[model samples]
Target: MPDHQYLLTLKHILDGLGRKGGLEDNLNGLLATMARELGYVRCFLAITDTEDEDLKLSLSYSPSKADSVSYAPGRGVVGQVFENGETVVVQRISDNPNFLNLAFGRTEEEMARLSFICTPIVSHSRGKPEVVGVLSADLVMLPKDELEGHRSFLEAVASAIAHQVAILQEELAVQKHLLNQGMAGLPEAQPPKNFVASSKAMRLVLRQARQVSPSRATVLLRGESGTGKELLAEAIHAGSPRAERPLIKLNCAALPAELVESELFGHQKGAFTGAYQNKRGLFEVAHQGTLFLDEIGELSLDAQAKVLRAIQEKEITRVGGEMPIAVDVRLICATHQPLEDRIAQGKFREDLYYRINVFPVFIPSLRERREDILPLAEFFLEEFSSEYDKHIRRISTPAIELLSMYHWPGNVRELQNCVERAVLVCEEEVIRTYHLPPTLQTAESSSTEISLSFGEAVGKFEQELLVDALKKSRGNMLQAARDLRVSYRIVNYKVKKYGIDVKRFVNSKSRKR
Candidate 1:
């Protein structure tokens, strides 16, 4: 009877795929049917992300909201199936050490009594079978032989859905290519001015931002400090229909707790001791525009309640006045810390979290997107050089290597500052290794062997010293020699060896006159 039921379930899923509706809809319906007929309480179909190759939860038969959860190759049982192109059957989920419950977050009590089975969804379109995804389901614990039979049944189901998965992959690949081409070919994609997205990780983030930009949905930019959350917020607002309206920004952590309410909502005369005149808050000032709240996790609980009210009601009340003022503002929030942890600690409101997380975009860290480092460095170098009236042309190859190897803890903001400083200290057309901060010289920070040789290091230091002395002496080699307590011949030799132009400094001084 069990074998007959398994055969019937497979026939139903294959037949349903032939019915009307889109590919995704048919696949979802197939999953639901499998779960119901196979006596499983939950089922999930994870498809491979075309870009990162991670297993992304595509469809499920559970009630939980679809999250941004993904599993790298060989991360868990589901990942293992996708990684090795094999099937996994856990007679008891709790006893399997490799079972990492990253998705669905089943409780330990429930896991103790459940059996899990996962099989790769293999497509044979290209002559050979290729694993395109994984089909996983959780069922009540049964006898060992029964669990094995269920695993074999799931493998058949995976085989049946392989054709639909192949078509889905092709459609997705075409859509992704078109989206990237559209972004690359159009100027509208560059609304976030001066933003550099050279890495695949960053490009993925840009795609997400573009998809959500045209709507009124609230956007939550989650990442570490200095990762350019404000720039992303600008991109979203600039792409939205609210581009012409004012884009108001406020850092929740920058202001004191006492002034947060006044800053967010407006205050009337005598609202507080210093509230001498009527002040329009950010919400009111951003009417029909976009309001970006940075470091939202730092907001006080009381302030959180008021902010939630403003978001939920689409209006705000003056601190001293009772009448509510209506405002039509799109909100974009950013936070370095995780709001879920904050909620667990009673620091953030769960309700507000849901309201703001309508569209969450995770910006990868600088170290994670190292491919973008050189482009961003060149950008900042050009910007700072023009600002400071320097003629720095390019960064040396050794300098580029150092920049790529070091881990940027402060993220893009830190990298920008680093490039700016290097430009300030650079005396010639090319920025060299010594121009970077000392922190980057350390092996641990650079994550490699010492980049500069002993003689190369000495030469860089000597060159920098020569440039400083020459600047003070106004191109007088004799005076520069005196400043360094060295002979004029030695100074001239060092200057010539480093290709330092003394007449440029003289011309610069003459121009200053």
Candidate 2:
């Protein structure tokens, strides 16, 4: 407490505040000041992790290795403070539940916990305080009574660190925003627009896609629903050597069991009640090209045997026909259902599974490729903007953050739909949080599905979509009309039907000029 000593401590505190590196790097000098001021073994600062959702070491201090310490939060006294979210003051280590009288490791101590305490770090986000991290420390260096003072000082210091961390996060979010803008600015791919994918996992899938696209070998694409299995099929057929040849696709699961055979292999005239003509099957039309069978797992056993024969022999027998018809076509199939499990259940054929699964590729779900979320969102913005003919720019920072945290159970497909909906409904120069679908606006608070009467849900959906077009049109009843894929008169009619307050969303020109 002497003037000269206090002056030196003040000098170090000022220096510690400006150090720009890890939490420990900035706090080390302060810990030294605390040690010198209190005549104790060490002073430490600990930060909790946003990950373990528990306090982990952000920084610490001690007599010998105070400059470098390691103790995972929830491990000892430090961990106890984190787990309980309370301060500790154990003058004797042997007497307390938290006491590890036999301390070994970094603390490696017979050192008593004369006084230890911790506090949560609540940081500011958008002017709102959030507990982004936690703070803790040991007052092994301070007087027993000033434990209260140490607590106060720790609280202030944690707040300061929290503020800095919040500011850094905001800046990062902004930089990411600009980077995404750059990515979105790239020219669109040639055709089949908006199949958004950019990540190591997806990149590898594209690799396999390229390899199988050129050959007549059967390709089986597998993944949970919404992982873009159909997109892969389309890409394969579009890029194959048979690009000029017809590429036919059929959804086996969507057809009735009685209709699947005629649907895939075609039928002779009057083969069945609905079969009035000699229709050409996918295999025949896709000769020298590709045939994609989606939800192939749903094929009946009889259908499976025929499909297997077609794949094996490169020929097909029309329904009610005796002779086989030769065809050369690449086969690509996909299913969300587990084929192995189905095979075990006798719902799928084991032999047929091996044929189409010759070159198997699994598309990872969205959560696994989280890094691609924003990228995909931005891609959809441009795609939908062009489709809707809106000269839109970007999405707001808050909206983008909301998107990043969203759990897209429906994967990229869901994201595409959300963004397209946002684009069509957004009236602002840049898409704001409000432009996002109700599912997103409500997602932050609840994970439950949005339920409504079928009619009500459809009405709400139609309203948001039309509102987006009105925004893009800038009140030019004509432009808004074109953007919605409806005639000007029809748009005007729906504008009334949806009860959109057109005046509220029109751009300046639409409003005044």
| Deviation of model 1 at 484, angstroms | 18
Error of 2 at 240 (Å): 2.6
So what's the TM-score on candidate 1?
0.56
> Model 2 reaches what TM-score against the true structure?
0.50
lDDT of 2 by residue, 1-513 (tens): 344654565566667767755434555666566566655454555443433454433344554443333445566666655555555655544446765422223343544444555565666543665555455444453465666656666566666666554433333343344355453332211225656555657766765665556566788898988988888887777766677788788989899998899878889987778777898877898888888899999899999999999988989999988789998888889988889999999899999988888899999988888878988888888778888988777776657866877788798888888998888888765777778877676745435344566687566656756765676666677877776667878877878887777887765432211
RMSD to the native, candidate 2? 16.4
- Looking at model 1, which ten-residue stretch has the lowest summed lDDT? 183-192
Q: Estimate each model's TM-score.
A: 0.56, 0.50
In model 1, the runs with Cα more than 4 Å from the true position are 1-189, 451-513
Q: Best by lDDT, which number? A: 1
The local distance difference test score of model 1 is 0.85
**Candidate 1 backbone collisions, by pair:** none
Residue 200 displacement (Å), model 1 = 0.3
| Candidate 1 local lDDT, 1-513, one digit each (tens) | 278998898889889987856789999898789878877888888887778888778788875555658988988888888989999889989999999988787889989999999999998766788888998989999988888888898888888788778667655664566577554332233435479876667867877776777678999999999989999999988877788899999999999998899999989999889888999999999999999999999999999999899889999998898999998999999999989999999989999999999999999999999988999998898899889999877787768888999889999999999998898888766788888999887898767787468999789779877876787678999999998899999999999999999987774442210
